[model samples]
Every structure is written in C-alpha cells, then in structure tokens.
Target: MDTAENRLNPPSQLLLALEVRGILELQAFFAAYPLLRYAPRGDGHPVLVLPGLGASDISTRPLRTYLKAQGYAAHGWKLGPNHGPRDGVEAGIDSRLADLAGRYGRKVSLIGWSLGGVFAREAARRAPELVRQVITLGSPFANEPKASNAWRLYEILSGRKVDDWPGREAMKLPPPVPSTAIYTRTDGIVAWQGCREQYSPTTQNIEVEGSHSGLGHNPAALYAIADRLALPEDDWSPFDRSGLRSMLYPDPLRSDTDSEAALRVSLAV
Candidate 1:
C-alpha cells in the first residue's frame, strides 16, 4: 500500500536535479586559480573522508586532493561505495581511524558526505579519543531516519532497514568531538531542516548554496572546512562565517527560525 506520499523519494527541485553541473564549475575554478595559495596551511594532521551512499572514493577525489594541497594528509574511506552498514564496514572504520591515529600520533578529523556523514558521526561517538573533529555534508541524521527522501532507496540498496538501525536517539546524540554540519536549504535529497545539529558551543551547522549532491565540491564548503581544520586542536572555536565569510555562508540557525517545530522534532529523539 505504498503511495507517493509514503514512499521515500528525493526532494523535488529542478535546481537540485541540476546540481551535477557543479562538477564542471568546480573543475574550472580550480584550473583558473591556484586555490591552495590562499588557503591556510594545515598542521599536517590526518583527515579521513567518507563517501555518500552509492558513491565510492572516486567521487571524493576532488575534495581529498584539495585537502592534500592544503597540507593535510587526507585519505579516502577505501572500503568501496557506501551501501549502509555492510559486512566489515563498521570494523573497517574503527580500524582505519585507529591506524591513522596510531600512525600519525594525532587524532584524525572526519569529513563525510550524505550517508557518509552518518558514518562519521557514529565513528566519532564510538572513538572520540581518536577523532579530532567531525564534519557532515547534507546528512539527514535526525527527525526520523525514514523522513529523508532517500530512505527507501537506501533500504533497497543496503538490504538493511532504516527503522531497525536504532533510529532517532542515535541521530540526536552529539558526537564527543567538535562537530559541524554543512547543508543547503535547497538540498534535493533530504529535508534540510532535518540535517541541522542541536546548536551548541561545540557543534553547529552551516547553510550553503548548492545541491545536496554538490556539497562535496562546493567551493564555499571547502573554504569552511579549511577554515575549521586550520584551527589549533586545543583552541577550538565555532566556525567564523563572519564578514566576508558571512556573506558567503548564511547562518543555518538564522535561516531556520521559521522552522522551529521541525528542529524540536529532530531533538525529541
């Protein structure tokens, strides 16, 4: 008895459907400028990026390359495409974080896209000592896991049930480390309101301009990530999207004031 209203489908938006074109723009932007020249150099900490559902490391190559150019040892989640909690995935993540931290003698920062962000948050919670910080792009980790337009497809692809994954409570719990969520109100895959973090000193959300799928390579998002990563581990501060940065990155909290009911629903779990 599944009807359109009850089925999980991507959010309907013409612009969101066209977000794939962002790749061309990204490539051109990188080619036109030595982007790394303006970026603050990192402290050579380890960074791990997880891919979205149905995407592999190849989709994250551009972001990883940019991070590497910024002086961080960025690595991809090499366990292939994310198809939910598949065999060896959780263990692989745990081992990967352990290996990177042990190898570099420093905690690793996690950057995850879409479903990958869900993985990042969980990993951070599981091993906060090994995680320096966590960032998520367009991940719908709250307000009922199945509320996302991508949920049914996720269930089909992963052969796992979203409802059975210990839903709402897990999504609402903040990771032990500093956490950031970068999402766009125009996201075509999930309800933007569901992607926000509970506002806190150690956690925040950034609203960007792009499609749900384009967040990985969105220049503004990259700048924000670099800005966050550049901070000293001991001197962590909330993202400063101030002045010029403010012009580019809108405050998600300010933008979502009209949707406080949804925010409350997200936190109820």
Candidate 2:
C-alpha cells in the first residue's frame, strides 16, 4: 500500500552530481589532519565501525585508524562487504558486539556509515547493555526504502526487496542508548530529511555540510564523531554547537527560511 505520493523521493540530480565533491572532502580531511589531532581524545573503550552498502572494512579504515589514534580500541565489522541484512549479517554483528564487549569488559560504541548506521542502530536496540552509544553518518533511517538512490543497488546486491525487509518500521525508532544522526543537506544519495532521528532526551540530529560519500572522512563529521565518542559513558549530553562549532555545524532545529526550504525541496525532488 505504499505509493510515490506517500514515500519521500531520492535526492535530485543536482545533489547526485555533487557527490564527486567527496574527493575534495577527503583531501580536506588530510589537509586538516594536524588540526584534527587536537579535536578530542577518547577513553580506552571499544568502538566498532561499520561500512555502508557495497562497501567493505576498507571504506572505514581511515575512521577506524583515527579512532585508534584517539585511544579507543577501534574495530571493523570484518564481514566482507555490507550487502544488507543477508543470512549471517545480523548474526555477525551480534557476535562481534558480544566479543568486543566481553574482551574489553566494557560496552562498545557503534559508529556506522549509510546502511551500516541502520545496522548499528538495530544492534544497539537488540543489546543496549552491550552498546555505549550509536552514531550514524548520512544514514536515511527514517525514510521508506525507496527513498534512497541506492535502493535498487541494495536489492541487486542483497537479492532482497527493500520493502520486504522485516522490522523495517522499527528501524525509525531510535535505539535505547544515546544516538546521533549526522546528515548533510547536500547529500547526494539519500534524502537528508530521512536521515533525521526523532528528537528525544538521548537522540540528536547533527547537520554537517558534506557529501554523503565523504561523511566517514569529512573533517567536520570526523571531529563531531570524536567529540561524541569522548563523552563519559554515564554522562550523556546533546552536542554543543556554540562558539566556532556553530559556524561549521548549522542548527538542525532552526526554522528553515524560504530559501532554505526551497533548497531542501529541490534536493528532495
């Protein structure tokens, strides 16, 4: 009973075309590497990084490396490429989560990119006691399956219909642990609105300016991730965007002006 009228549309061609900016974003990350080192340091906790659709642990290497440098035991899913929730995908994540938590004797934080974020959220939901928090990068968790440009590719890769995925409705619900959804208005793959989490005491949406493909390595996104991960396990607070951060990360909750709304409409189209 789903219809185009009811489902959010994928990003427009303009946004899709802008995905190439990911290259520049990557360069920017390297250019700012020295500066990034001063971003934030983390406790010696375990952190799991999951890749997006069709991407392997390779895509997350830079992020995992950065986390490791920040004093956390960063890990990759090690399950080949992410091809949706195929047979053993869920089990693999569960096993990894248990293994890391058991080894570290501490709850692990989950940071996922794109489809990986969906997996991370669900993993935390299934085992909140084992998860410290969840952070998603450019993940359209709140949208219908077809609302992303990669839906067809996801089907082709996973051999599963996007709409037929079980527990699809529950995907929109934020996990019990602290959750952060990082999104970009100029994202080239998924509708930016779909990347938002329902606001709650422990749920937040961070608007970063970057391409969907580069969120994993984008400097602003990277700093935000480091900032979030550096928080104490027992003390959770919404991200502070005051001072210089305000200029880099726009207020997601601010009322969009006519121009902003128009731009959003264009991207959604």
Candidate 3:
C-alpha cells in the first residue's frame, strides 16, 4: 500500500514561481552551451531513447539532435505511443534490441525517461549481454501502486495497473555496466525516494536540481549525461563526492546557492 509520505509532494507557491523562472534560465543555458551543439564522444555505439509516459519521440528531439551532432547514433522507440503494458510489449522491445544489436555490432545503451526507465531496466534484465549501459531520468522504481502523483491519471487513461511487476521479484538487475539513475528531489510527479534504486555495487543514483518535467532538457542534466557516456567502457566509476560537487558547482563564476535555492523552490511548488 502506498503511504501518504510515498505520494507526490504538493508544490508550494514559491516553487511554482521558481520553476517558471528556472525554465527560462535553463532554456537560455541550453541555447548557449556550445558543447551540446556536438556529441561528447565520437564512438558510434547506438543509443536508444525511450520517452516518458504520454511523451512521444518528438519530446526527446532536442537531446536526440544534440547526441546526433556529437556523433553518436541515437534512435527513439519507433513503436507508437508509450502507454504502459499492452500485448506482446516485451517481445517487441526484445525484437528492437536484437535488430539494433545486429546492425550496430555492439550492445546498445538505453536512456529512458520516467516510466520508460522502468522498461529499459526490464529489458536490460532480459538481455544483459546486449545492453552496454542504462540511464533513467526521474523514474519511479521503488514504490508500489499510487505512490506516484500520476498513478490515478495513468490508470484512468491507460486502463492498466502499472504496479504489477511479474517476474520482477526474482529478477536481479544485470551486473551494472555504467548504469546511472539521475533524479531530482524536487520532482513533482513522483516521490523522490521512489527514484532511488537500492544501493548496489553496480548502480549509482545522482540527485540533480530540477523539476521532473525539465530533466530531459536541463543543461546540467544533459552535461552529466554527456560526461557519463563519454567515459571509456572500463572507466565507469560510482559517483563520488568529488564528482557530485563538480557537477553541482561547475562554474566558479556563478553562485551555487542560486541553483540550490531553485531546486528547493521547485520541490515546494
């Protein structure tokens, strides 16, 4: 059963104000960031992007475009809308992975947003050998039914219970190969704790400062993603205090508290 604390935290008025301002600031930053104009790494491993619930491929186009410019082969799930669980969904994902593997001659990296992250993790569990890494943005993996603010709305729209995770109980996550779960404490859509994966040797959780909706577009988030992907296959390391500080306080020219306060305001909203 979902506890009261497990549900989404209501946004405060201040949070709403900050989010509006943050949105503008974030957009400007993305526009100015020259690094995002090109791929961070030139190696050509395929990256599959799965959009959040109710989001289409178009929603992920900015990141996709940046990735393409950087020289990575990025693709979105060509299957129609991302409504949770319909018939043969698992098989369809498997087929997609197989096809990409055959064409690329390498395991594919998956970057999933929101519920799409859950799907990516499940796919990796099914075919570890075919997945190079898994990254999820603002995903809810630890909670049961009604834990997320969208639970009721999602059920109403899709007519399916998403909390049911058959075969998920016994399934151990594939040995972590550069897996990164990026989430924000200020997420308005899902409980922040739900975004946490139980600590494991292979899995690492990164806390970012942004709203749930802005994660995919946040400049800081994108920089982190690019940095992670750019790491050599053997160089993957758990996010340490040094790395976190560097990411959170990348610019000596700007005040870190501005971003930190913005994150707090977003959560309050």
Question: Which predicted model would earn the best lDDT?
Answer: 2
lDDT of 2 by residue, 66-127 (tens): 88988899999999999998999999999999999999999999999999999999999999
lDDT of 3 at 197: 68
> Which window of ten consecutive residues has the lowest lDDT sum in model 2?
255-264
Deviation in Å, model 1, residue 174 alpha carbon:
1.2
Q: Per-prediction TM-score, please?
A: 0.87, 0.94, 0.80
Higher lDDT: candidate 1 or 2? Answer: 2
lDDT at 91 for candidate 2?
Answer: 93
Off by over 4 Å in 1: 1-10, 13-16, 28-33, 255-269
Residue 200 error for model 3, in Å?
A: 2.7
TM-score of 3: 0.80
lDDT of 3 by residue, 1-269 (tens): 44675454433444444445446635855785695554356477888888887877887777777777677788888766777766776687788888998899988888888877878888887788998888888877665555566776677646777556575544334334557888876566776556666666677777776677777777767766776677666566765437546757233223324444665575579
* Candidate 3 minimal-lDDT segment of 10 residues: 249-258
Instruction: Please write out the lDDT profile of model 1 over residues 1-269, one tens digit for every residue.
Output: 44666544445555446567567547754773376448677999999999999899998988899889889999998898889887789899999999999999999999999889999999998899999999999888864665666788789978988776864576777788999999887676787767788877799888887677778888878888888899899778888777887887886657445333443365476
Candidate 3: misplaced stretches above 4 Å? 1-26, 37-39, 167-176, 239-269
| Candidate 3: pairs in clash | 11-269, 12-268, 12-269, 15-265, 38-70, 39-70
